[model samples]
Target: MAKRENIGLSRELRQTENRAEEEAWQTLRLLRKEGWPVRRQHQIGPYIVDFAITKARLVIEVDGGIHREQEVAARDVEREGVLRADGWNVLRVSAQFARHGDHLIEMVRAEIKRCCPLTLHPSPQGERGT
Candidate 1:
């Protein structure tokens, strides 16, 4: 269950978030249908990630125009470093990717696979099972 404050904050963010954010959210919903188990505006540690797959320890960030600014870019770099040090895989995507199409899901899936490869189980016959 989410805390009341975080729930309220997320609601407020949803209402005020830019079009890119809203669109990215829709894409994330589609990814969920594909079994990614991602959450929007999820809080992790001291910051809020645009989307997170806790079980996978993946954090997704959607960068808008403001992200291009020097200060924001620097902050983002620092934040990502912290997350990485904490053993979280951070994937950053441009909001423009959302405007174009649903390719974001594929990209995220690939990143997940790269960051956390699935361990194969052994078959009864001593073969590897995918």
Candidate 2:
């Protein structure tokens, strides 16, 4: 539960991500390149989320088939509740849906826009303007 342990666990999770997570990560990487400060296997409080946009207080979870089980679903609900209580918006994407990288990007973009629209805009000279 310590910060050091969370960092180690996050590193392991990043290295051993499932296929769906990998697909989502690829799309998230694109978002990062576009100036969205996205992080993978990011830790939030005591939980390690699949992806997080810290500035937007958003956490994105790619739910696999195992999440369909009743027990896992219940736990997920509890987790989401805790995150929501802490002012973090949770977005759950099915593993099947994550396979579509374009759709995943769009979903994340919409969530970010809805929660925290980017303040910076590009100027005509390719510089960032507030």
**Candidate lDDT values, in order:** 0.75, 0.85
Query: Global lDDT for candidate 1?
Result: 0.75
**How many residue pairs clash (N, CA or C atoms closer than 3 angstroms) in each of the candidate models, in the order given?**
0, 0
List pairs with backbone clashes in candidate 2. none
Question: Highest TM-score: which candidate?
Answer: 2
Per-residue lDDT for 1-130 in model 1, tens only?
3576777787777778788878877777765455556677877767778888765688888898889999999999999999999999998888888655458877877787787678222122221221
The sequence of per-residue lDDT tens digits that candidate 2 reaches over residues 7-125 is 99999999999999998888887875656767889888899999987767889999998999999999999999999999999999999999899899999888888887654532222
Clashes of 2: 0
- C-alpha positional error of residue 107 in candidate 1 after TM-score superposition, expressed in Å: 0.1
Error of 2 at 101 (Å): 0.7
Q: Against the hidden reference, what TM-scores do the models get?
A: 0.79, 0.87
Candidate 1's displacement at residue 49, Å, is 1.1
